[model samples]
Target: MNAITQINPGIRQQILDAFNFRHATKIFDPDRKISDEDFNVILEAARLSPTSFGHEPFRILMIQSPEKRELFREFSWGANGMMNGSSGQLGTASHFGIILAATDELMRAGSDYLQDHYARVKQLPDEVIEIFNGAYGKFQAEDHKITSGREITDWSGKQAYIVLANMMTAGALMGIDSCPIEGFDMARTTQVLAEDFGIDTAKWKPAVMFAFGHRAKDPEFLKTRRTMQDTVSWF
Candidate 1:
């Protein structure tokens, strides 16, 4: 099945209920960790999130090893602002970091990447984000205007958040807790992974990361939620 297709409504309430139960965990139990299978379930959840087109839009880097996770913990400088750190005795790193990156390597000059771009665009039907991003790509090539690398990274990075939300929600349904981390030095991270992983820096840019593990205690506060009508109303 296409990853982006919305699930049927027979169990929509159950799914939304799962969402209601979800929250941004301030800490996870470092002594305990998620099973490999459950981790894959969350990865699949991310894979199933919607994208601008059929392009899938990003790659998943699951860093579970202690060394790697520690490296991220040390280098992750800017991701905490989004942590919503209302309160905490001590932060946990159970889920460690799951890196969601846009794979623009396929986005470069002639290769299967360009072909996949066209193919996905053809499948977009009436999607607005697709329409806009597709046109933007064309404009980039023809107008020959150079958008800063950070600009392109930021633009694509937004999509990763969508994937992050879905994964957290789905993980919550499985009785897992998550911390959506935006407090990290992404460029520096690219350097660390590049040296060891043999990954080319340009092909992938870090969009976001999440730490998942069992919640150690109650969150300090119930996160505020906006009603549907308040969040959306007819003009």
Candidate 2:
């Protein structure tokens, strides 16, 4: 079983208070950035997020170079809003942007882990690699829209969202600002990165990117939230 550390009651309240205080910051102060240690703490929160079947399926790409940030900004469709809106007054990301991805390798790797763990189970055949391979092939074939490898990546993408949320909440609690982004020229960005780094275009897929920095001003969280009374009902 996964063990969680006992947090102080006071600290837990602070964390909850932080969550309630966070909002989608439109702009960040360009002169301000999150400290390296603090950024790592935010990443650690993402790492601690639960995953399906214990397959922690995502790689985080922390991009920080000014040139790269500019290049990335060009493709981020959401940036136009940030550049011209309330966030503009505060400035834009001083810290690097984070890109999340899932690769074909991670899925195959997860399958291997599952097979290895199941090998010593009771009622399991001592030599059933062939049977297992066949079953795996069938399982792979069941995916209609994409290859089995791609399916694994799809599964990983969902897990990545859990990490995104954790990081956003964690960063906010640490007094960092974040913009969860899904609007980008993904294919173009992927092409640029893959060609530049010689990454296999077929294997890794871009999921989403996050913009992080210190908030230049307080975020106005004017959005409405649903209450427990509206959402929960005992059937």
Candidate 3:
């Protein structure tokens, strides 16, 4: 059945409950692992997330091997910051997802990469396709004028956050806890990915990371949130 047809009152409530149950989990149960089936579902949610202009700018690296996790843990501890030092979550969590954003070269208009991406949507008249490409080029040019390609990373990184949120919510729906990690040193992370995984840093940059597992126990802090009226406004 389609999503619209399935959204009855019960299903709607379940959706809200999923959001309510999710939190930035600080402590994870080291022994508990998310089943492969459920983990795939979470990944699927990220795969299907929306991106601006259909650029699909994010790449996800799932780090689950014990040795690799140890490498990341040591890196996080060595990074100079309160947040990095407190990253026990990375060491103990069952899995880590590193989100990387595509570099300017891949997303540049008229590049073979983007042309191939746009061509796959559907066959368009040549004139229409030209118009689309021109518009995209103009947009990128304007973005570059303002930030000199730095905005490419910023824009692509924003898309990765969309995937991150979707994966976290999908995991929550499956009774998995998640922590959105933004405390690591980006330069060090880029170095690690290049040295260990052979990922080319010039082509893709690490945008963010996340930890997933079951929560060790109830959090000491209660759920404190602003009411809908306080945060939302009507037209």
Candidate 4:
């Protein structure tokens, strides 16, 4: 690889521009489709995102079948309709995704899943794995006090959001629109996944969902935020 020397002048502005261009697009142009190439890039961005301990204890389910999307209408209040009566993200977006975080059984300090992950995926030696697991056990038991199954799952779920953010930003940089959704009944959605999608709820639970496509129209309001001085602090 060639060594890099100087930074591009407008690189920072370009990144900020992508953030400004992105919005919670509620409606998408059904007629427009995201190319397989571009969508794969978004998925790759998600694949490369960092997770706590490199565990990557999350999986993404892409919902593309019309039948599946139609089924979501019954549970996903956030994606069922637009305020203006147009079809919402589920009905019109070119792609939809459900991010599933691994359950507590797979994430506990010395669980079988973590053991295999350390030895195989992370390529760590047996001695190193033992040391790492000891530190992780303490982190869970004392530092974070993650005792209950619910607490463990919630911790894993937070890592899924990191991947979700990367995928959305990648799409925005490519001029694709996206919306992050959390407006579904968790119990109902979980039941639906188990019954219709053949997902094992015992091992994985849905953390969040998203929709992606070309926006049907521009948002009416400009993006707003607090001033940088008000939002950040220098130590």
- Give the best candidate by lDDT: 4
**What does candidate 3's lDDT look like per residue over 1-235, in tens digits?**
6665555788888888888788887767788988889999999999999998778988999887877766666456422123534447766688887999988877767777777776775456677778878888888777445234567878889999999999999998888889888777788888889999898888799998888899878777778999989999999
Name every residue pair that clashes in candidate 1: 78-183, 78-184, 79-182, 79-183, 79-184, 80-183, 95-212
Q: What would the TM-scores of all predictions be?
A: 0.71, 0.73, 0.87, 0.95
Alpha-carbon lDDT, every model: 0.65, 0.67, 0.80, 0.93
The lowest-lDDT stretch of 10 consecutive residues in candidate 1 is 81-90
Per residue, candidate 2 scores C-alpha lDDT tens digits across 1-235 of: 9999897999889987887767766677777867889988998998788875444657677666765656655567665455555433112675545445556664563255446544643234756654655564555456333355667677678888888999999888887878777777878878877876565656567777777887667755565789979989988
For model 4, the local distance difference test gives 0.93
TM-score of candidate 2 relative to the true fold:
0.73
Better of 1 and 2 by TM-score: 2
Root-mean-square deviation per candidate: 6.8, 5.9, 3.9, 2.8
TM-score of 4: 0.95
Residues 118-177 of candidate 4 have per-residue lDDT tens digits of 999999999999998999999999998997899999999999999999999999999999
Candidate 3 stretches greater than 4 Å from native: 1-7, 75-87, 120-128, 143-147
Instruction: Give me candidate 1's TM-score against the actual structure.
Output: 0.71
- Give stretches of model 4 more than 4 Å off: 1-6, 82-84
lDDT tens digits by residue: candidate 1, 14-105: 78777766776665666677888998888898877786544555777767566555565555643332344522212355665555455545
Mark the regions of model 1 whose C-alpha exceeds 4 Å error after superposition: 1-13, 77-91, 103-105, 108-112, 116-148, 227-229
